[model samples]
Structure formats: C-alpha cells, structure tokens
Target chain A: MRVGELSRRTGVPVPTIKYYVREGLLPPGELTSPNQASYTDTHERRLRLIRALLDVGGLKVAAIAEVLRAVDDPGRPVHKVLGAATERLGARHAEHDDQEAAEAGAAVGELIERRGWRTDKSSPAAADLARALAAMGRLGHGAFREVLDDYAEAAERVARADLGYVDRKVAVEDLVETTVIGTVLGEAVFNAMRRLAHVDASARLFGTRPEASD
Target chain B: MRVGELSRRTGVPVPTIKYYVREGLLPPGELTSPNQASYTDTHERRLRLIRALLDVGGLKVAAIAEVLRAVDDPGRPVHKVLGAATERLGARHAEHDDQEAAEAGAAVGELIERRGWRTDKSSPAAADLARALAAMGRLGHGAFREVLDDYAEAAERVARADLGYVDRKVAVEDLVETTVIGTVLGEAVFNAMRRLAHVDASARLFGTRPEASD
Candidate 1:
C-alpha cells in the first residue's frame, strides 16, 4: 500500500506519517523510487498501536516510544511494563504511595484530636488508613501519620458515597485511576463545574431559553 | 516577615519565593535595604493559594492567574471562571472527564444502529448517559458526546463500588476528587498492582521477598 492509502485507511495524514517515520516511531516503507514507497500490514498495525497509545492511553511520544520498545522487547516482563506504566500514571501531577496522602490525613487527625474530635474507627480511613500511616512512617514521613490518617478516613468516607453514583458502570481498573485523579482534581472541578452549572441554568432561564411551558 | 520566615510560615522555600517574585506571581516586598526586604501575611496567603492551585488543582500558572483574578473580581460571575477552567481541561484526557466513558456509550449506540449491537436503552450505559452526551453537545465537543457518555456510565459504576470501600472516612468534596483521581490512576494501578501481587506471591512461593524486596 502507498502512504496515501495508509493515510486514507488510518485517517492519519501523510505528513504525520512521514514525521513518525523520521522519529523512528514508524519504519520506512520500501522505496520503489524517490517519491514512491510500499507499506505493509505491519505498518498499519504499528500506526494503530501508536494511535491507541496516544489517543486511548494518552501517552506522550517519548513515553509511547519507550512503551513500544518495552512491549517489543523479548527479555522484558509484561508485568514490569504494566507496573511502570501504572506507577508513571499515578505519579502524574500528584504522588501516589507518597507521604502526602498519609500526611494530609495525619494533620487533619491531630487537629481533630486537639479539638477533641470523637474519633470514628468505623470510618474507612480510621484503621487501615493508620496502616497507610505506618507505611508512611516506615517510609520516613512519620511526623503527621496519625493526623493524616484521620483526614484519610474523612476523605475515604466522602469519596465512597460520591463513588456510589459511578459504581455500576466501569471496570475496577478505570475506577481506581478516575478516583485518584478525580480525588485530586474533582474538588476543583466539582466547585468549578457546580458554579458553571449555576451559570448555565441562570443563563438558560434569564438570557437564552424560553420560559417554562405549562 | 523575612523570606526565611515567610518560607517557614507558608512552607514554601525562599528560593521558590524568589522565583515567584521574579516570575511576577508575587509582588516584591518593600525594600528596607537591598539585602533585606520583608514579606507580609498577604504574601504567605498568596503563596499558599498558588501552591494549592498548582498542586491540588493541577492548574498551569496562566490558568491559575486567570482563576485568581476572576475570584478577586467582583464584576465577573464566578461561574465564568469555572467554565474557563473546565474548558481548559480538554475532553481527550481521561485523567479528568470520562471521555472514554462517553465515547464508549456513543460507540455502542452507533454500533447498535449501524452494525446491530445488542444495546439496551435500559442498560446502565444507555439511559441517563444520554444526558451526559447532551451536556457534551452543549459544550461543543458534540462529536464525542455518545462515546464520552458511555465512558461516564462505566466510570459511574466503578466509582460506586470503590466509594463503598471508603465511604466512612472522607468528606464529600474530598471523596469525589480523590475517587476521580484514584479511580483514574487506580484503574491502571490495580491492574499493575494485581500483576505485582501475583509476582510477589510467586516470589514468596519461590522465596524472593527478603533477598529481592529492596
């Protein structure tokens, strides 16, 4: 197949295909002449894989390159590749498995304790969260363990209820990442979206939409 | 307060404060002398706000600046700021909205109509999910409406289950954001973690933890 045919088939531009070739993300087609080349099924598959990684997985070109290499490497364990990808994702913009979550929990816990908060152990964040704190302590961020544990408990409870709305649809994997990112950005998005919702409703009511029909 | 004191108070470093001042994010202190200028509580508060916007909100500096300006502006509706921020978060990133969720629904719907997929309107991904598609339609990413709604349905289900685990501990807002982020990353994490669990179990069965744990 020609590059144009590949482009037509994949909906990717010929120029972008050329760029991919230049970047070594795609192997060069067999040159029939200076301006003509032949492609193959392998090229189509590679392009599809790249598109999936970029579009579906949202990986950077460099990260995609690394992932492709790992995927193709015979010596590399698929588990390791998966692990690295997950860890990389979790560490995006926010550190997962770091002391921050634990510390945040502990800080709130100590404050609650100082304020004579009736410590609720039945809370999702109470004991196991304290276990996370102990893990943080072993990791050397022990100062705010207890306090962070308390906050973790509070955070856990609220998140659980919020998630109740989403539980019936997604797979377990999608749920976890969405929850993490949602937890991190959802607060901001929630407030922002809520405010925008009010604006949208008001605008529809006062500025755009017709009055309610009886 | 001196830069050192400001650092201690805000938990931001002197170097970072200097960078912020240089970047015009913070107004420079009144110069008592070239060597020593004092910061105020306003500076500390601004720094904390900046950190929260950057760290917790994951906003770029330019976006944060706009948000801060809108927050401070009495004339502007708060919702406009929220909309701007939400819009800045692209629909392609699964880290934020369930673009995949919406897309999946859309895909299924299209498939059912075109290729005769066994889609149920009463199915979790079919009914109210259409509302999400409608919302996305209004948002101008009309092409992605159906697929994104499908993803949302799936995500909503996962969120429900995950939240059930942490409901006793967290606050509503915190829980929502945490779950969103957690589930997004957790999806990836759990898959990886599950594999890791298997690997670790295999290692333990084969006696590899003490020698290879580090």
Candidate 2:
C-alpha cells in the first residue's frame, strides 16, 4: 500500500507518517516511482508502536528512536536489560547532587538488597526508583516508603508473569520488540488497572459506588 | 518568607511561581507591599507538589490545577476515588468512537468483572486501560492481552498496599493531597520497580548481570 493508505488505516496523518519516516522511526517505503512509495504491513506495525510509545508510554522521540534502533539491530542481544526503555520511563531522572538524593539512593539500595534481587543501584530503573522516592520525601510523604516492599514483591510477580507470557507467545526473533512493548505499554496497562483497583478498594472502605464522584 | 525565598527553597524560579499563582495552582502569597508578597511554608510545599506533578507525573498544568482544586475542596470526601488524579494519568486519552475501541472496552469490562472490582466501565481508569489495550492490538501484539489477568492481580495488590499506606500515614485533612500524590507519583514508583524487576528476571533467565548493557 501507499503512504496515504497506511495513514488512513492507522489513523495517522500522511505528513506525520512522513515525518516518522524522516526521523527514521519508520523505515522508508519502497520507491515505486519518482514521486510514489509503497509501505508494507511492517511499516504499519512499526508506526502503531511509535504512536503507542509516544501516547501511552509517554516516551520522547529520541527515546523511541533509541529503542527502535536496538530492535532493528540484528546483533543486539535479547533478554538483556532494555536500557533505552528503562531510561525513557516517566520516573526517569538523574540522581540529584544533594543530601536528600543521597538518602533516597541509600534507601533504594537497601530495597534492592533486601528484595534479594540480583541487580545494581546504578541501573536506569534504580535511578528512576531513587528519583521517585526522593520526590515523595520532598512532598512530605516519606512514610509512603514503607510500601516499597509490597510494591517490589508485586513488581517481581508481574515481571515474572510478563516474561512467562512472552516466553510462551513470542518467538526468539520477536523478543526484542515484544519486550519493549511489554515494558512500555504494559506500564500504561498496569497504571490504569491500579487506578481502577483503587476505586474498588475505596468503594469497599467507604461503602459508596465506585463511580461515586464529586 | 518572601517570593524569592520560596523560589529559593523549592528550586522553582520566581517567574514560574508567579505563573503557577496566576494559574491558580498555587494560592497567591500575602501582599506585604505594592511589589512584594510574603509566602508561608504552605507555599513552599505546594510549589514542590506542583513541580513534582509536572516533572514526575508528567501532568499538564491544567491537570495539576484540577487536582489541586480537588485537594482544596473542603467538601471533597475522603476514602473515595481521586477522580482528578485518575483523569490526569499518563495513560489518559478520550475513548475512541470506533470498533477497535468498543472491543477493547469490552475486554476491560470483562477484566473488571472477573476481578470482582466494583468499578464501572465508564471511569477514566477504565478508558485508559481500553485505549492502551487497543494500542497493543494495533501493534500486532494482541497476544499481549492474555496477560491482562496477571496485570490486574498485581494492580489490585499494589493499589491495596497504596491505600493502606495512605490510611496509616496521612491525616484525614491531608487525604486529598496525599491520595493525589499517591495516585500520580505512586505510578512512577511502581513503573520503575517493574522495570527493575524485569532486569532482574532477565538476568536470572539469561545468566548474566542485571546491569549488563548493550
């Protein structure tokens, strides 16, 4: 199909698709003529992935480009840390150069050690956790850190389940893209469900309908 | 303290503080003179909260304004859904009026029912879930839908832990702000941890260090 058909089918504009092509987020279509190019099903899938990362994962174009580059690299190994995906998460921020950041970093270190998870504190995900924990301290919600254990346990279970799903359903060739999608869009899925679950818990606690509103 | 002191304390610039004040995200400081205003500790905390929501939660200024409005509403009930916070999440998007949306909506409804959650399908969180699910479908990872059950279970666990944290750590008067922070920033914490856990799981499965890079 042509670019126009690809845009119509995916609900993306032609100009936006061209922009993605220009950005190398989507591969250039095969040239059929001097002025015409033909896209494929692969282009459609890649386009949707780009949009999903932008809209749902809240990732920047530079981050998406990094992850996609990893995906398209034939030599890139699978089942390794998806550094780009982790670095691009919403919680991602550099460790602050201050006492508060130092303390948050220590707390994150302790959580990883206590959880018995074989990981280091310098990973992008750890920096993300440290930054978020530090922000909570600034917000005067430092006591909220008590739930870190529970959250980490839940994270492990979900990660295991996520890996299990990909192991069963995704082929080795598709592992990188599947892992990227599962890591990014999967966060959106879990965030939404967590909010929904909050309503249910609140309904149980307050005895009001979950849809009870202001 | 004065505006300069508040800006210094929170690391927010004077112009940004004025902008937030004009936007009603921060209450105006008390006027001490024609050109100067005195701020309180409350101003400092509110500024930090606003910045955290903007930076960590990835919320728009308009959404932060809405959430802060609810936090200030004296009549807003405690232990109910923090609807504004839910509406402002990164996954947030209007439900599309199309066949794909309808199917995703149905899938989300089924998950809610299966989990025995008390929420309805019309909530902001539900719409977020449906949109994310539809995006996954478009990416040709529709098989990813099979993991919804596991994700929902983990969400419920995390949400319950979140409410418990708030119930114990937050005073009744602070419930609204606490809930909003917990909802928005807590998602960041969980997302980061999940990614961290993914790295650990990958390391274990692939027999490598979790921090192994490209």
Instruction: State interface RMSD in Å for all models.
Output: 13.8, 1.9
Residue A171 in candidate 2 has what lDDT?
84
Label model 1 with its docking quality class: incorrect
DockQ score for model 1: 0.10
As a TM-score, model 2 comes out at: 0.94
Candidate whose DockQ is highest: 2
Candidate with top TM-score is 2
Q: What is residue A153's positional error in candidate 1, in angstroms?
A: 14
* Candidate 2 ranges with C-alpha deviation above 4 Å: A90-95, A212-214, B79-81, B90-99, B211-214
DockQ for the candidates, in order: 0.10, 0.70
TM-score of decoy 1: 0.47
Candidate 1, B1-214: lDDT as tens digits: 8889998865677898898887767778878888999888777766765664455434567765554554444443422433333333322332223554466356446633552222233332232234333333322224432233333333333333343433544454333323333322223322322222323332333343312111
Q: Which 10-residue window in model 2 chain A sums to the lowest lDDT?
A: A87-96
Write candidate 2's Cα lDDT for B1-214 as tens digits.
Answer: 9988897788888998999999999999889899889999998988889988888777889988877877886764564427665665534543456776787889998988888999877887888888888888777777777888888888889988988987778888778888888887898899889988988888787787754554
TM-score of each model, in listed order: 0.47, 0.94
